[model samples]
Target: MPTYEFFCHRCSKPFEVTCSIAEYGRKIKAVKCTKCGSSKVVRRISAFQVQTAKKS
Candidate 1:
């Protein structure tokens, strides 16, 4: 699962949602805001976490 960052226009707040890429693509309609329950949400460009093994 990847954590996606989103911003709510109605609430003027930011939030995050963890879901699979397939599910995200399947979400044709706009995502609902966690705080204000508004569908006017947009995905935000955020950093991703990368895990690398130590060189032993």
Candidate 2:
């Protein structure tokens, strides 16, 4: 499973959920707002960091 970020349009809050890649590809259509219980949620582009080894 992978973590995905979501934004609730009703409460303007962001939340995360863990699901399979297939499920993620299917798209989230009925996700409820974790804070306000609203179904108007949209997927958000999450940022991640990549670390590299230092040069010798």
Candidate 3:
């Protein structure tokens, strides 16, 4: 699962969702607004987490 940032076009609110890539893609395709309940949500550019393993 990954975290995604979404901007609500209706209410102009920004939100984050933690879900799978497939789910996220579906949600983004739907573009449903969470705050104003409108199908006009905008997908915002988000930063991905990076992990580094220690060299033992």
The lDDT leader among the candidates is 1
- In model 3, what are the clashing residue pairs, if there are any? none
Candidate 3 vs. true structure, TM-score: 0.61
> What TM value does model 2 have?
0.63
- Per residue, candidate 3 scores C-alpha lDDT tens digits across 1-56 of 76677888778889776778768657667756656777777667643332222332
| Clash totals for all candidate models | 0, 0, 0
Candidate 2 lowest-lDDT run of ten: 47-56
Residues 1-56 of candidate 1 have per-residue lDDT tens digits of 77778899998999988778888876626578989889899887743332222332
Model 3, which residues run further than 4 Å from truth?
Answer: 47-56
Clashing pairs in 1: none
TM-score of each: 0.70, 0.63, 0.61
Q: Model 2 clash pairs?
A: none
Better of 2 and 3 by lDDT: 2
